[model samples]
Target: MKSVLQQLPESVLAQILENAFQWFVVVDKNSRILYINEDYCQFLEVPRDQAIGKPVDEVIENTKMHEVIKSGMAHQASPHYIKGTYMLANRVPLIVDGEIVGAFGSVVFRDMNDWKKLSSHVRTTMDKINMTSHEAPNKLYRLEDIKGSSKAIRSIKETIQMIAPSDLSVLIEGESGTGKELFAQSIHERSERAEFPFVKINCAAIPEDLLELEIFGANIEPEKHHRKGRFELADNGTLFLDEIGAMPLTIQAKLLRAIQEGEIEPIGSNMTKQVNVRILAATNRPLEHLIEQGKFREDLYYRIQAITLRIPPLRERMEDFTELANTFLQQYILKAGKRRLVLSSRTREYLQNYHWPGNVRELQNVIQAAVYLAEHEIIEPTALPEQLKQVRKKPVTQFVNLQDAIEDLEKMMIQHALQDEKDKRIIAKQLGLSRSTLYEKIKKYNL
Candidate 1:
């Protein structure tokens, strides 16, 4: 037996689909909208032509047609909100010759009243959650976003999962470029306090005198512009204090009192208010050294350091470079609207060998730069930053024994550049030698 779609011409088939689906859309394999019904267009307050060829995300308020097409799986009775109304939707792959060619989506509701009842129920739950505006930060990164399999990163994730449920104050210690704050936020997201607001402030960024006012709420004597302090805003939630080592001694005493007593006195107010906030602190500085120097209070240090987690820098976790590079490549490629891109073997070696002082953050930036700068699908060493190309040329120390010194210098430079700038041609050019001569010297020197 032939199906209606199989028997009818494409022009008649499209008209039949438009009439049957009232609120419907069809997308290509790439998740680009190919067709939208007049009913959906009327609800969208736009013309049918306007919605076509745009990505599904831009076309629909909350649609999963793209995911359905990508995974070749049908999603039925999925909750999707449109124009502030709750709706149930079905998205199925449009298969051709047993191959997924695109996706078809339609709204599923008994009537308008059915949608209203469901929407009201969901809204009640949302009101109870009361998610704050600051809760969802930039790029919406979480634990899964770490994208590394190195032992150091694995341990960090494990430790965070273990400690997140507790109400203890966590002190995150790491170098400037390491993702200390990312781990802290992941902890907050996994904890029981997930429903509450998550606020963040950098201690180093605020002035010493203004830091106190920032912690405790302040009322500016101006023409009607007011602000809430961190404690008040973060009540019953998590407050992330970044660069905690730079906090003033006076502010530290107040912060310690607040942590111990569960209360805070807002600036310009005589009364103190109670606030129940989980504190997550981060620092790149040495608190112990500050304590010894009489710059930091021991009591406050102990209060905040109930638990300490140290993040390993990228240089220490080159084993994770491959995954990290690919993760960044895919991310940038999607954003750039380009096809899949890959790093050459030599480029990968360069990434693995370079000392990333700025850690994961630096690698992400370098890759983002490479995605746009690299001319071909395969990223070559020529596509990397000039600093990476000219690395290891500056000697760390002076050497004696001219012939031995030259050999040692060559070996040191090669090793230094082995991970991040591995093209032999580039290496030869940097060292002022031919490719064959460079290989001969590497063999002679056993480097």
Candidate 2:
């Protein structure tokens, strides 16, 4: 009996092969190139004519594919990371009757945009929830979207990546709106239990008596049907407890019991039910301070803080300020149905000087509010918050780095020069630097 593929006509087979995503190629037993698809050549950044006569090794830079062909074994390969981009390819030996006939392979480039699309789809479909806005895909949180380029932020991301797949408990510490929950979700999404439910409960939102019942489930009388709590719902998955510091000291004992003993006894029921749940907790308050004040239990703290991660605030990582500002601007402009707007030179200066006490969430809200209020195409100083407009003249000796201090002085001088002359060339000549150098310094300091 012949397979359906083998039963097809030559023309039909040719059309099916041409339209396929996986590029196919055939090589003779002697390892000479015989036939190749248009994509196969295109993937290698070579012409079809150039690829047809060349051997697999000659066409492809990596010899892995060629080795698989000669060995008469099928090979599966993922994106070959090159120049900060992932590229994928696969090679398989073609067998006919009892003889090794030839080899075939396929290749494709895995761009950042494509990965974002795939990640968004996976996040949406697996969670069956609205993880992000429908308008943009790349806006979904990544290591780059964390609003920080500091070594601390990079270290936090690296730690999360290392522990995301582990079952150990994680305690994330950060200020309010510093994206602690976002980090928790990223861990859940990357872990082995990604397909399982990710349940979130705010410890501060629930009363002490109700918190236990909410987590450990409650029993109903024989007359009524009962409901299960988050633990049961999130069994074999993950439960993110936000504001863990806000949990009552009394209930903390129960939580410890549940953690130590994998079973939870309901409020009314005497029997304990086993639940397998991974706990990911976050808090803004300092647990050590609470421990000193006798508000937080030290035992429970140690239990939950098997691994701790500190998320840096926006002010600490100023290098990411411009990137985050531009991202939020693009986001809210489309959402608010306003004309495209870019931050003016003055606006950037105002943003850089103003301390972001509210972190990334505050920045997002500011952008949305500014975009909604702006009448012009470009965001001006007037469009900014009132706090930003009140820039105070402070002493400049705070910077320890003299070079940075000099740049700051030069920027202030240039701003003053611009006000008087209104000419960049004149300002450059007066500053005793080239026009290109002046422009470069202006951009570097975001003057």
Candidate 3:
């Protein structure tokens, strides 16, 4: 028996598809448009001839054709925002002979008024719920988003999986830009509270004067308007406190109380509201040292650190370096709407040799810059930043005596440390020397 498509002529079938769907498009496995109906071309204000062979994303605003092709999954009645209005769209992979060849997609709604009516009804229903004006931050990352396969990363992932089911407080410690927040989000996503809001606040970013109001909510002096704090917003969910070390000692006491009692008193309100919030705190600095220095509260430290996950810096996991670099490279390449590009062997060598002082975040920035600077399909050392270009393999040196060799090594170490760290105290601490001894060594070495 012949199928309907097989029985119909090619031109008739094309016309039927063009008129039947409000808007339709088809893209090959590479996300390059293979066929686009006349209606979609007219809507995009592009000629049919010009639309074909171009990337779907370039022609259609916020199109998921590429994602459908990549995932080989179908998106049915998904809300798609185009221009200024939201429309339902369906995207499905086009398979032939058990192989996905491309993707076929179309807008589901033919009448704009119908969609507007539905959208308005949904918004009205949401408004009735009295959702907070200050929306909870979206949990944009998952464990898969961590993007590393090193033993260190794998062990941390395993630990997160094991601890996610429990309600224990998690203290994530890592250097700045090591993706502590990503791990926090992953834990929330894997937990029982995954359906609830994953609220986050950066202690250092918020002003100290306003920080209390931000966390504990407040009633405006003149307006008498009551606002919900992060604690209330994160009720029955996870609250991620980023840069926890930077939280003021004054606020620390209240935070400890909330964690212990499961209640929060708004700034102006006399009554305390009960909230069930799972706390997940992250810090780039050593909280223990801060406690000793009378900066961070010791009790708060013990409260938040029921389970600790320490993320190793990029330098410590060199095995995942190339993979991470390539991942970032691909992301930037797609963002720039450019063809596929690869890092040259020499470029990779330079990248691996350089000490990533800024960690993963720094590497991502470097890759983004290199993607735009690259003139060819390959990213060479020339495309890297000036500092990265200056990085070179150290040469073997011969010394006259052991003392001379030791002194040279000491001087070299100091030079590298100076370049890596901006704080002299941190450098001294890392080198196992006191501030005075480090200064004397620096002066003696003329570093």
Candidate 4:
């Protein structure tokens, strides 16, 4: 006897499955996507071709297909969050001749209205609870919040995923506005300490006199009220120390002892307390240079940098500029209660040409300002900040004389050849010029 699936034609079977389930996907034993229906691809906003052959988790957020494959257990009517909605999904291991070969998954929302009604009810219940609750939820950034598809961004995200599961101390290095704090939050969110409090303190922002008290709380002199320090407050959690390079040498020694011993002694107290805390430190300045100058402790630097994650500056990842700019523009537009606005070609050109010294933060500020300044649907160059408009890639100077143009081209070629080849003979040979002529041109152009 043939089963119903076997009885039906392949095309007919595929069509039935595609229409029956709102989203469907299949992954191999290795957890690489083998097949995904068009509906699922459309819902994910990823092209079917692009999604195929990728890891299931990379393609679908919060997917359990891999777990299904691993455990060979079927999950029915499980709530899975995708994008912004909670979906009822089913996952089952695919078996052939009593051997598990892969996994099959589907999100079943037979009636859109039914899902909408359920969602509305859940939202109302949550709203009521939130209104009565005194404690507010912590605003911690997740891995997805670090937006960018550039190679550098992807590499950093992959590193975070690999390191976040461990209790290793991480040193995040980047420019002033490269979203170091966001990355720190992402690490905490992905770590085992996610449910615990995530404490943060700026070493540069606090005064030296009170810095010790801030990190290791002080007992009140008159009342002797015992206050919890950041280390104690973040016990069994994560503490992010921003601008760690600016920490005074006096405090650096204490920090080293605390990290090394997993203990801290509060100010005005002789007793020491043990706390299980994961430390994540960040600095815009090079700690090595500071160490050479005797401003930072080398021992402390070694302790914190169990792993280092360097965030690329915005200027280095210009490929992501348009997407980032648009994201910020939309965010500010919604805040201002305005309709959709897009950057004009000229405005984009100006933004792309300028060197973003302040990095992602500066780009966000620029877009926020443009959102309000834009009079129409399109943001013109005039809507951008004055500095961005003024500091553009210098326009190519036009050559008037043929001799001058030839000399300019020769100089550029010789400079590039010299950079590639250290030997003058090799450079001359590469540039197809005589050694004497190359030397003359090099002296003339001052290469």
Candidate 5:
């Protein structure tokens, strides 16, 4: 049997190898080519009969494959040797017993013609195998879980819940960190098409040149193939466009076309595929301002504003500060694995008066910081960040008694004079007051 196998014709052996793979090649210990399948010949741009007895180095001279044989080890590279290519390969030495032998390998080619196809194939495969890719479509957060409980916030949540089942495009207006996207998610989860995808696209995140391709997708570069945009991904579902005010005028036109027609056409393709998507757009700025400035499209604004929802600033909803603070404290305590903490009466009082420039988002961040920094289970004023400390300090004085007020004013005035004049004697002269009076106020006020 060994003699018969050794005496087998090259054509018969090549036929067996071809049945096992698309391509195959074999070499002796001398690194001379002993066999080449039809696929291998075509891949190397050589004739099978002519390549059979030739050295692999001569067959594909100056190539990385030759280096593999020379070093007697497996070698792999990418976008290598061949121009305009991207390749992944596995090469392994075939050793028998204790004797050294030759090797075999395989390559998956990635060129301009096949890169898109390969990438798409990989994405589809991964999506099929990964539970995360297909589950619970849009991201989730709740209205009750939202930080505020003031009349404005209660009314807003009630409106959000009421409109949750509707298919109308929701326009969420709020400043940064007001959680417009959270509102968008709440709507989608409650909607009739909750099982479908909830695709999000940040209109302000992408460059104008690429935003078109990102939103409507493209096919001009065949290497990238034709991709489906957010609208397509959210078919029978919802699409959230953040910072909608920053979207370019030209792209706005395309968006309007898709909304009106209920379909999108890829950049390089003329065919339009119907998409069922309800758009929820959010922006901190006024769309009317953008329209007046000629920065946003008027028709598109009307299309997206079918049902507008405005979120009031934290300063405007100051009545909810304590509730928001307590809720945040509970969350932080649980997350930090600490004992339940009650806010100090002073802290709660000061919190209610804060302007909260970053709104609910800022409040959450502040409470979280305080929880981690607190020495005791109770959150004290000192545990807050330096910025919050400054905010709370100024506000706490507002609630002080008349004596404290007069004393604080006296201290402030003297500090200002000293800062301005750079000397206590000069400050007394500048304020038209005696040095003894200045010294007395300083001592009494603890300046």
Candidate 6:
């Protein structure tokens, strides 16, 4: 380039720059506007003469042009909010003969609708980034949102249906991300107390000092704004205690008494308020093991375990992964405003077979991240999270004993024979065994 500005006349240069931007403003070192285009003045609804003499910030809401002038540096390609709208702007120092005299600024898409259309895609990408990178949500799940076709899941649903109506203390045990809260809500909704509130508190999330105050209402001074605890708020309804195993042994005694007496005595209070609350407690920790270690109270365990349910980890229920994964993928795809992104069959199979140590939550998170990274509408296995992509299916285990090994081998051979040749005699002949022997073996192995 041969110094295009030098070759051009001042009036010609002004006309070209005016046409290039939706809005333009030039400010001197004092941040006093030296020049502003007619469009910018019209957008601000101020006359060009008035805008030129004033500071850019005084004229525009949320202006950062003053920053560029102060720092003598460029603030390029950054989002600048003006009048409750996001705009792409670049503010660069105007250096004349190696001396910083002023700054030049230009904006694109002054129309709010145009900015919204452009920024929507950016927002979608930002949401994806947040979903993948941030911590797990305190997600509330409904009974219908629960995904699984496995017998285990069916049984879990049936159990909730059976037990939810009852007024008993239910203890839920599972690995983290097994959706303990999901099950708890299902039970609550199915219960007679569904019309009332459902209050949940993670005993581990609150500090030990504040945990007592949170669970049992405090009777401290200035009682006007003093509020009820989880127990009082959940009166005549369901109270879900997450990570109940994390409660200190000292607090366990008080909790046990509350359950046993059907009332809670707040700290620093002699009076006990009667509460008809059904307790649903959950924990990833082994309560029995904790009791044995004397870290948890045995009496507390008995009180909470009046009705116990254990959710099997995701790896154990591989049959459900495909459905669960797609459910998550669909939710996130709609959230990101992307298409109905499809997962390749190979990707689905790989996901189903992989060991999900973090369970359904991990699967959902990985899918969200994948949806963000996917180039096309179809998400390949390569788009999966780094942890999931590195997962290798474990080799099938060998039989423990010679008798078991021989039995499995015989069973496999018999199944293959039956699959290929339907007739009993033909199957026997193919296996080099007599029909009677084959029948006896089939009956013995229950195959």
- Each model's lDDT comes to 0.76, 0.72, 0.82, 0.82, 0.71, 0.77
After the best TM-score superposition of candidate 1, give how far the Cα of residue 40 lies from its true spot, in angstroms: 28
> Pick by TM-score: which candidate is best?
4
Would you give me the overall lDDT of model 4? 0.82
Which should have the higher TM-score, number 1 or number 3? 3
What does candidate 3's lDDT look like per residue over 65-106, in tens digits?
A: 888878888997776756433557889999999899999999
Better of 2 and 4 by TM-score: 4
Query: TM per model?
Result: 0.61, 0.59, 0.61, 0.62, 0.56, 0.58
Tell me the TM-score of model 6: 0.58
Cα shift from native, residue 277, model 4 (Å): 0.6
Alpha-carbon runs more than 4 Å astray in model 4: 1-136, 394-447
Q: Return whichever of 1 and 6 wins on lDDT.
A: 6
Which order, best to worst by TM-score? 4, 3, 1, 2, 6, 5
State residue 241's C-alpha deviation in candidate 2, in Å: 1.0
Backbone clash total for model 6 is: 0
Segments in model 1 whose C-alpha atoms lie over 4 Å from true places: 1-90, 93-139, 222-226, 391-447
Instruction: List model 5 lDDT by residue over 337-364, tens digit each.
Output: 5545667766765676667889889988
Model 2 per-residue lDDT tens digits across residues 2-70 = 798788999897777777854666777766678777645534434455567676667665445566656
Q: What clash pairs does model 1 have?
A: 349-419, 350-419, 350-420, 350-421, 351-420, 353-419, 353-420, 354-420
Provide the lDDT at 268 for model 2: 77
Ranking by lDDT: 3, 4, 6, 1, 2, 5
Worst 10-residue stretch by lDDT in candidate 1? 390-399
Task: Assess candidate 5 and give its TM-score to the true structure.
Answer: 0.56
